[model samples]
Target: MNPAPSHPYRAAALLAMLSQALFCFRLSMPTKLMFDEVHYVPAARHLIALSGPVNIEHPLLAKEIIAGGILLLGDNSLGWRFFSTLAGTATVLGVFAILWLMLGRVRPAVFGALFALFNGTVFIQARIAMLDGYMAAFTVLGIAALLWAMRAESSGTAWSRWVLGSVLLGLAVAAKWIAAPFVAYAAIAFVAVRLNDARREGRSIYAALNARPIGGIHRHWPGMAAIPAILVLGTVSIAAYFATFAPAFFYTVQPMTLAKLLPFQMQMYGQQTQVLPHHPYQSAWWTWPMMVRPIWYLYERVDGAQRGVLLVGNPAVLWGGLVAVAGCLYGWWRTRAPALLAAVGLWLGSYVIWAIIPKSLGFFYYYYLPSIFLCVALAVSLDHFARGTRWDTRFLLLVLALFALFYPVLSAMPLWGPNAFHFWTWFPSWV
Candidate 1:
């Protein structure tokens, strides 16, 4: 393994800064609403304008952050997306830290940040104003905290880590409903860590368990004692989730009560079931893994000038991630390594939820969270690939190279119109 710098976060800090510059460079390219910005930016303006929130299906944290940016930047395009850019950059940093915590190595963590930056999933989402970007940042924190909490042998530190993870999970959902999977993820991790701790106390517990039957089970039930900690974790998360809604009550003139809130929630639920009028970009969850389709956020040509932003996976990181994820799953099954297990488990937790979201309408960008997890899974797999060769480092360069190749279309930079669209339209659905 390549030795990491003495300061682990330095590479990540550089990555975050670079990503911010990249996302913010042409901040007003289309100079108008781009993709989902139509729904979110107005809601943010509403927060400041004393207008009612227009988009309530999603939670309020992302809009609140965007509103802060708008308040500072004067209700323009840059203002609309400023906070999203920050959240996206933070996603890169958080990915790095999560890898650092998981691998305890500098090089792999750096690989994670670079992979996420060039992957185009997080970067595209980050550049635009959207709920998913905020969710991505908080998801990174939740996963990192869960891993740290799992690793803690000290009870107090473990509880604190769990609490932090719980609160972050709550905040993640506050940014978007899709992030609810993280809460389930933390609970699963907590149970696995405690059970593993119990089993490790002694191998003879197996024999003891075999012979003693109910008593043996009783004797090994220390894992159950951690229930209070689990309860506290749940409480903290719920409290944090409620706290995110306080602004909805305070900022608006209308008083929020259960009478008003209940129907509002049902209205949000109703929106989920409406697939309506056929969106060109929407796809099933299974297709996202294969990069079958991409959503077009914007396409504009005014007075012989052209600019566009396409939300598509950069094949370098996205496809490479699939191979790496397979490596992680296979290696974990073969070696029973805790680190591999953690990566695989986390990837599954974030991804599996999509299969059951109950939303009739979904898009390529919904894969954003899983795609970021893929980068981490790839980072973990690097430990195995890097041990005996330099091939893994070469792969990192190739990922960057691919990102460079796609930079123009990805960033909405001008090019010969047909060539630009043709280069990006590798598949029929992508148009």
Candidate 2:
């Protein structure tokens, strides 16, 4: 491990930003929207025109972002993708900062940032107009802020951290519904932290929990100032959301436009719940852990030449990540530390919800956000090993190199046109 410098964190943040920017820049204008781009780009244009959200199924947050980009860049293909590219870049930097604050080391943070930068899945998503990137960015930021709040013992900055965490969480939820489970996971983690404090103080757990803080708040409250700040952040995000839409949304759209839109959302929700007869590329959750079914968001024949790429994750990273997650579970079981526990909770809680939901049209792409947990877990594992032996450091470097080498093949395949299949697809579901 490198020596911890008096102020090494800023340098690390700059590297993360530069790495992500370069990675995103590689394929920014590669091609038009692949799959869902058709729907999202139009929605963004509508949003820019102050068109009612009548045609859109999701919240206005992502559209608003895309709209901003379009307004500035002009309504071109690149314009629609601008926000996702920015969000993807932000996600890389945020993850690096979070890992640094949580792990208190440079290697783990660098491993995560580099891995995310070269990960085929993350790379492809960053270059498109998709809600997933926005969701990932905000969720990671929220998790990082929450971790900061937990680590801060002093009341002075804790409230501010909590407020930032809450606002980010709210935006994350607004971006995608899947963010709900993360909230539950966070709450559970916080309660556990409270319990730990109570146990240490030799007080009744129940009393310790309910006890208030001194002076400003209830006496005995543990970082009690955070709750109000969190509430304020939440309220503000929600208010900001509605405020953006304003009377223009409700007053402008025709009654039928909204009526039709509401039913479409319900239908989409219904579509999500009802299992399709079968999809050629339908992937099970278990397969995701193994990278068994990678969705090809876009594929095209350039000049009748096959040159497009696949969208699967870096196999080494994804496969190793599975092992890493297991290791994370073991670490949490043995140590009971908040960080390890939070990793496991996030991995399980975010994904397990899909098992119960009756969504009919679930696809492999749905695994995108949850895969981040695996990446972080793998990073944790790599960090552990990197601190152990020279060979371990070599192994980690090998993985990063492999990720970078393979990234081009996957990301550039679509640009290759028809002959892009030079790289073999081992699984039928991959096509």
Candidate 3:
């Protein structure tokens, strides 16, 4: 009934454009660095001047992106944060692209983007100059590319997609070291594919002992080379990581080599143990899903008015996703849907990563990445209901309503007093 069903390009574009406009609502505010912006904005400034590194533990690629923003927009809050503005907006588009690819419908494609865009974490993180937003942007793009590659009908098309995805994956990790786990996910995914292929072809495990030729064990995987796919992913990712270090080359000779790299790694590893001044808003990872506490990225009372940035997920989306994930698990068990499995796998895997990390390093913000996938999981559940456009559209409107209600606090809009914050702060811990 709408844009040609052959492609929902117009709907996707409308969704992305509108979301970008919301994220760009106040491209310049506070006129000063917020929490981690203090770490990254200065690094970008230092980068522009060709000075030594500032936030070295995290790679400089994303900072370089910020620096490019500075170069293009002039060294104001907007300039320092311009690329982040772009990254944050692009993340919405990336999520939309992935959803469109998976669901292949206009309603879910637009609603999925809306779900993620309104996600308090995605909304807030994308607007600022922190690595989390950029990391998320690259990751979704990488995933979109990988999924596109898998759908390719020809080897050439598939290889191109893999190359693009690998580079994006490397760029994703370079933005934040925390994303390194995704690389492991990539490798593990390759192994899982081969194992599944063997299972489908009825290959026997006894072949290892009997030297029986694994008839289907070595069958060529569609769209990607079997064993070598892992090598390609690893190699391209490492290359992508080093390429972001290009700015380092200008500042230090042999900066990308193992000689300088190993020492930097050791220093970064050592610095992780150093104590930092305590933050009042810091929260444990387990408490994040419930949003028991929110870390304030910015807080100030100006002339009897209050404006602050509190990193918290949207209540409806977060609470609903919590329930929808169960539906995902149930659906995966029932239908063996690959998309369902991928969504559930990523949602659970991202949360499970926090448990293994030392509590000292874990925070509610670490939950941000997984929360993006949770939106996907939620969208998957909605699509499964087969309720058609009427129900899903209304649900999307409800999500947008929440975003509108929370936008004042999400953007730290000036309020006569702290009273407005209280309206949205459902939990005492949120204060």
Candidate 4:
């Protein structure tokens, strides 16, 4: 086989185009909203009409984007799903960029992104008009920008990347409160890295504060610069998040005002925090990594054909990714490789935190963000253990084959009958 391209952007663009074509293929097949689209699509319509809120439990930016799609495309199935397809495509690119920035290689980046594309969660979420697809896209893009800022060679370039990261993270939270943890992780990680650098250089706290630049930006107290920089960036993120509520201020009914912002936030919090009943497809945080249960978004007769959409991870990627993540953790312990550290950190921030959240119910689809990072870990592990060998090619082919095998259920493609799902479900829990 020919070698992967040396140019990162060239390789990333090709992968992105492929992902977009796959995500957009048969996107409007269901011809109607499925699952949570029942809630979000109507909210998008309400936003388009300047009508009152419909799904106030979440923030507004994602719905606003969907509304913009409807306005541009005349409120059809394609309109409801166009931006989602684009967000899903961006997510594919974001994964490529994150691995590229972290590992500084084209092969791992390409492998990681292809794994993510074949991973069922991103593909399924992209076809539906839901919040998680947009949220996951912004969260990964924010992480990629932050990784770029850390390695930037010039002060101006670093500052621009930092600001861009902050804005993207803020937009992520505006998409859904589930993204809030990632923003917090970004802030804490930035400060910790700067402080660790100071300690590593054997500089006194005082000298570290006064001698060096933060991300190459000159500061009077360079060590202490992270404090003020974080403060400013935090404010910027808050401003970006609140800006998404702009449409709320103009609602034809029950308009929101600046004075009411805090109270509105309280209301949103109350709505999100309410204890809910259990769902049949709900899986515990611990069960997620093992793919113990999968959510069936839709499974019914459509247009006189048996059709379904299952939000399950590609087993070849997800099941194998667990071993890859463990390998990454061991590699990080042995060598402290920055790429391994990043892959592990992304997984922890997105997945482990779910264990501590107070929500009474959780679904398998909530594993979406962490699954993306799992692919990253798999890429890092493969680069370390199997680079320049045929295993890399073989593993990718395996993932692709499994993706194709599961594609029928992952999309709403016609099946032999309701029992056709049994062909793919190897375990009872998956039902």
Using TM-score, give the best candidate's number: 4
What's model 3's lDDT at 319?
Answer: 82
Model 4, residue pairs in steric clash: 209-222, 209-223
lDDT of 1 by residue, 7-107 (tens): 77567667877988987888666677888889989888887775565676777888888989888997887788888888888888888878887677877
Q: Write the per-residue lDDT of candidate 2 for residues 1-431, one digit (tens) a residue.
A: 12223454676667657755665564544455667778888887766666465434466577677778888887776677767777887777766766676677766777777666667777777877778888888888888887776666566566677667767877876676677566656655565666676676665555444525333322222355334543555575555444434423443454234345446547546544555688766777766777777776656654243445466777766777777778777877886654565556666776787787666656777887767666677676666545565643564676678766666555553344454454546666666
* Model number with the top lDDT: 4
**1 or 4, which is superior by lDDT?**
4
lDDT of candidates 1 onward, in order:
0.75, 0.65, 0.75, 0.84
Model 3: which residue pairs collide? Answer: none
TM-score of 1: 0.89
Worst window of 10 by summed lDDT in candidate 4: 215-224
Off by over 4 Å in 1: 1-6, 203-225, 251-253, 302-304
Error of 4 at 232 (Å): 2.6
Instruction: Name the lDDT value of residue 27 in candidate 3.
Output: 66
Two-way TM-score contest, 3 vs 4, winner: 4
RMSD of 1: 4.4
Q: What is the lDDT of candidate 4?
A: 0.84
